[model samples]
Target chain A: MTDDVAVLGAGLHPWGKWGRGFVAYGTAAARAALLDAGVGWREVGSIVGAATVRGGYPGHVAGATFAKALGWQGARAASVYAACASGAQAINTARAQILAGIADVVLVVGADSAPRGFFRPADGDRPDDPDWLRFRVLGATNPTYFGLYARRRMAVHGDTADDFARVKVKNAAVGALNPNARYRKRLTVEEVEASAVVADPLRLLDICATSDGGAAVVLSSMEFARRHGAAAPVRIRSVSTVTPRFPNTVLDLPDIATDSAVAVEPSGETFRSSIARTAYEEAGIGPDDLSLAEVYDLSTALELQWYEDLGLCAEGEAAKLLRAGATTLGGRIPVNVSGGLSSFGEAVPAQAIAQVCELTWQLRGDAGDRQVAGARVGITANQGLFGHGSAVIAVR
Target chain B: MPRVLTPVVSGWFAGDGDDFHLVGTRCSACGSVFFPREDVFCRNPGCEGGDLTETPLSGTGRIWSYTDTRYQPPSPYVTSPELPWRPYALVAVELEAERIVVLGQAVPGVTVADLAVGMEMRVVPGVLHEDAHTTWTTWHWRPTGVAG
Candidate 1:
């Protein structure tokens, strides 16, 4: 197993359509995390910022922007972008700095002020770009892909629309307790059924919304944590940032076609499963050892997909696990106790870090109403566009 | 004004009616195929390098999955704002020979109701959008044996 980095502090700016710029949200979350960590801004040796594409130039160089906002004291800085996995990439960057002894403490931040309605490609006609081509050629939006997955599960695994609704119902119930969540009201299956269909087999309620929010974390070396009197801080044991193997058979976002398996046989292991597997291997732990999980629930149905991908259950048994209440709080293993993206919507760059924040909170027993009992180990899984695979394992 | 018919993106597909097929590139060394036609290089990691040649994909495949857009998509996807929005069905078809899944819009009027996974679908040419001067053409997927 790799050397562990301590999660000294975790914080968030509540998610919603707050009509503010990303910098404001990110700065707030960073300040909160610094306060929680009991560390001064000048004390941080480095800063890593997860970038957002929509925020113009400042968003691209987010590390400097955040550093400047936090009153720079010559802290080394880095910025990264991996679509939805941007936050995880930032965390990994901080962990690397801590492990490499380049920095004793690193501040990692991610935030986004998302656009309304559907997430669209940048304005202009660049036929060479697959993201633009999908919209121009087929008018396939993000929800369209979610619908395809949900329907595929129905056809292949016999997952019904009701099963999909149960995920939202369960998450919303827990989300109601999370002050950081955007949607707090518990939903019913009837409500989900009555919602407008954004994509077939997936209703508006089944899908996550785009929101403006931020999340941040403070990472430090184990020695640094103990010296700071954080004697038993929750530690990050692994961060898996993997890419898909060649001949990726599943059709993913922004692509019109899957890689042909003519030259190479399919790996059988999907990109998502491989992400969790890599994390498990690195952390020297397995799914059975997990106290809880925080997966990218872009859609309620997709959460079920992650359940199987994370090895929380066997293939085609995600729905059965959900039906058995195994994934709900007080069950064998609770998933998405932080309300997930279903409750938080999506803050893009901030989401992966936010998942880790939730893990830290749960592991520390700081999640009051939504805390899992005696939570000791947690994992987070998410996939970014264009073949970015991310998962993290944390232990208390 | 008379309208001109043009492919939305050139070199991705060619021909007419039943003769039409999506164009892809095949690696001479690795035999790997790429859609949206990779012209520069082969994507296979195991192969050192190879010549990528334009190849026509299979005319038909079976549906891997299907879904429909119930809401209007944002800009860059041309639509008539003056007219009421109409949703369209999209299908991901798994080609048997090349072992690739290609996605396309179903023929106009075909909704999610008519589609089922594993149903045979064939690629056909269709209009993506029409302007005062030209009709932008793209590929569509239709169930095999059904007349369009």
Candidate 2:
């Protein structure tokens, strides 16, 4: 296993449609993280910000913006944008700095103020851009893709719409306990079924909404953590940012077509499966060793997809595992104990970092009612636009 | 005024009726094909490089998956504000020979109920939107047995 960086602090700005600028939420979360870490902003050697495209210039150069907002201490700054995986990429950047001895302590932050309704491509008549082409030509929104996946699962795995609702039901039960979650009300299967259909086979409640929120984490080298008296802090074990192999068969977000597999034979492993496998391989652990998981439940059915992709269960058995209550809290390998995107909606850049924040809290035995009992090893799995694959493993 | 007809993005597809086909680029060295037509280079990692030639994609393929948009899409996807929103089906078709999945709107009147995974589908030309002076033409996927 690679050398670990200590997660000294984790914090968040509660998710919702607050309609405020992303900087405010990010700064608040950064201050909270710094307070939790007991580290002064001046003490941080570097800062990495997960960028938000909608935030304009400041959001694009988020690292500098956050650094300036936190009172410029001349800390080294960097910004990264990987769509939904932005947070994980920022965390990975911080970890890299720590491991490389470039920074003793690094502050990682991600936040977004999302637009209402379906996410659309930036304005303009740029036919060269695939994101624009898909929307302009086919009008296929995000939920359309989710519906496609949900329907595919139904046809291939015998999964029903009821099974999809059960996932939302399971997550809502736990999400109600998370103070940071935007949607706290527990939902029933009937409510899910009654919700308006945004796309066929997937209702509005089955899909995650776009929201404003922020998350931040403080990381330090093991030596720095020891020096700061955080001798046994929750540690980040692995951060997998692997890209898809050639001939990616699955149609991912913002793409109009899958890679042609005519020349190269399809890799037996799918992209999502490879995401977790790489994390497991790097962390020197397996799914069996995971005490809990936080997967990007973009849609309730997609959560089940992650369950199988994470190797928590055999192929075509995710729904069976969900039905058996193996993925709920107090079940075998509990997934999304943080309420997931179903509860938090999506703050784009902040979501993945928030996943890690959940892991840190759980591993530290500080997650309150949502805690997975005896949680020791936690993994977060998320995929972003284009070919970005994100997964992080944390252990106490 | 008489409206002109044009492909939304030219060079993606051509021809008429049963003779119509989507255009893509095939790598001479690796035999890999790219949709939306990759003109610059081959995407295969194994092969050093190859000449990408314009090739017509298969006229028929099986539906990999299907869904429909229930709500109106945002800007860039033009919809008449005066008319009530109408949902349309979308299908991702898997070409057997090239082994690629291409997505497009289903022919009007087809909905999610009529589609199933692995059902045979074929591409055909259709109108995407219309302005005072122009009609935007694009591709649509239809069940092979269905009449246009």
- Model 1 steric clash pairs: none
Report the first chain's TM-score for all candidates.
Answer: 0.99, 0.99
Stretches of candidate 1 exceeding 4 Å from the true structure: none
Q: Which lDDT tens digits does candidate 1 get at residues B26-144?
A: 99999999997999978899998899999999999999999999899997899998999999999999999999999999999888999999999999999999998999999999998
TM-score of every candidate: 0.99, 0.99
Residue pairs clashing, model 2: none
Error of 2 at A232 (Å): 1.0
lDDT of 2 by residue, B16-110 (tens): 88888899999999899999899997888898888999999998999989999999999889999999999999999999999999999999999
Model 2 interface DockQ:
0.90
Q: Chain B TM-score, candidate 2?
A: 0.97
- lDDT for each residue of candidate 2 in A326-380, tens digit (9 for 90 to 100): 9999999899999999999999999999999999999999999998999999999
Where is model 1 chain A poorest over a 10-residue stretch in terms of lDDT? A124-133
